[model samples]
Target: MLVKIEGIVIRARSFGESNQVVQVYSEHLGKLSFVARGAKKTRSRFSALTQPFTIANFLCFSSGNGLPTLNQADLVHSHQAIRQDLLRTSYGAYWLDLVDHLFEEKEPNPGLYRFLKTAFDWLEQEKDPDILTRMVECKMMAAGGYRPILHACAQCGSEERRPVTFSIYQGGFLCETCKHTDSHAIPLSDATIRILPVLVNLPIDRLGEITIKEETKQQLERVIRSFLMEHVDIRLKSWDILEQMRKVWAASDDSTST
Candidate 1:
């Protein structure tokens, strides 16, 4: 049987000297794996279309009992700007890894596709990496149906000014009373909560217009890391690299301050 789908290449791996195994997170099929023949050799037709982060239209054929093989693929958007930049490359890998782990095979999810496309477009065009990361996290969280509640306390009914803590067990922000009850709860700020919705709703083209303070950006990053650690089941390589990057940055700042 032959299947056609529009998708972004999330992962690519070498199968043999002449063929490669590729996994795409598709708009129509959720996640699907394919074998692309001779993609690594020079002047391959499927080379551009099979690379990670590439968006393309693909024709695949399967025996109805085993893995599919790519018959033809046409590139729609390669997003070279994002693939070339060092900072953007790191973030792009992180984003795709998260997507790959969270989504299931052949499950149709239009919202997830939209989020990935928009996020890549933003990272390709946006000047600031901080805003891009924030926007990605907010939308990805919402699309994944794991967004932390920012409006009300997860434990208790109070909405007033109160110490906020995140309950990985409860899956959102908690009130002072809840924090007092649990020792594992992590602190969060009102500013981080306020900025989240903006990231969720705003378009990628407009992301550069919003200026965020470094402190607020760090806070948001921490909140996102904690949430992913609790919810995402798969271990991510890019996330480990990102954490090391942050640690290095923090150590440098400490030394400079001293």
Candidate 2:
């Protein structure tokens, strides 16, 4: 059957000497892989449209069983700004990898598809990539049915406690009284605790209004990373590379400061 799909290219790779395989997360069709014949050549029309992070409308023939064959593509947004910068690309790649890993093929998730499209648009606009990334992570976790409890205690649902810590194993905030349930819960500052829900619930369009302290951002990163590792447990090559790049940059900064 011939269909028109609005999708964001999540991943693309060489299929043969001349063909390219592109995986896209569509608004109505979820994830679908398409074979673009002769897309490897510079003159091929599919070459640019098949690039990762591009949002496009695709015409394809679907057999409802095997890979679809891409017939034509109309560019919506190339998101070239994201591709031109290394840091942005790293963060964008991580988001794509996370989405690809969390979602199953052919399952429609319109909310996630819209969130991803908004994220790429914001990234291309030069919004703080870290903040955008954190928002995406929160949204992805929620979409995956593993949203951490940030509004109240995960163990007992108490909001009257004075101090709280995040527990990866328990899957959210633990009130002071319930903190004993997890001996290794990570203590968070008031700021970090306050921002957790905001990150999770805030609308993507209002991202510019959100400002986070460096310390709080660091703590948020740790908590989110631990939560994802404990629950999702998927290893992403792009995330690994981003970590390495951060370490190298930190080392360079330390050397220059000394």
Instruction: Give each model a TM-score.
Output: 0.85, 0.94
Q: Please, what are the lDDT tens digits per residue for candidate 1 over residues 188-210?
A: 67776667657767777676678
Tens digits of per-residue lDDT, candidate 2, 212-240, equal: 98888999999998899899998889999
Model 2 ranges off by over 4 Å: 249-258
Q: Alpha carbon lDDT of residue 205, candidate 1?
A: 64
Which candidate has the highest TM-score of all?
2
Least well predicted 10-residue stretch by lDDT in candidate 2 = 156-165
Give candidate 1 misplaced runs (Cα > 4 Å): 159-163, 200-206, 244-258
The whole-model C-alpha lDDT of candidate 2 against the native structure comes to 0.89
Give me candidate 1's TM-score against the actual structure.
0.85
Measured with C-alpha atoms, the lDDT of residue 121 in candidate 2 is: 92
Error of 1 at 147 (Å): 2.7
Query: What lDDT score goes with residue 81 in model 1?
Result: 85
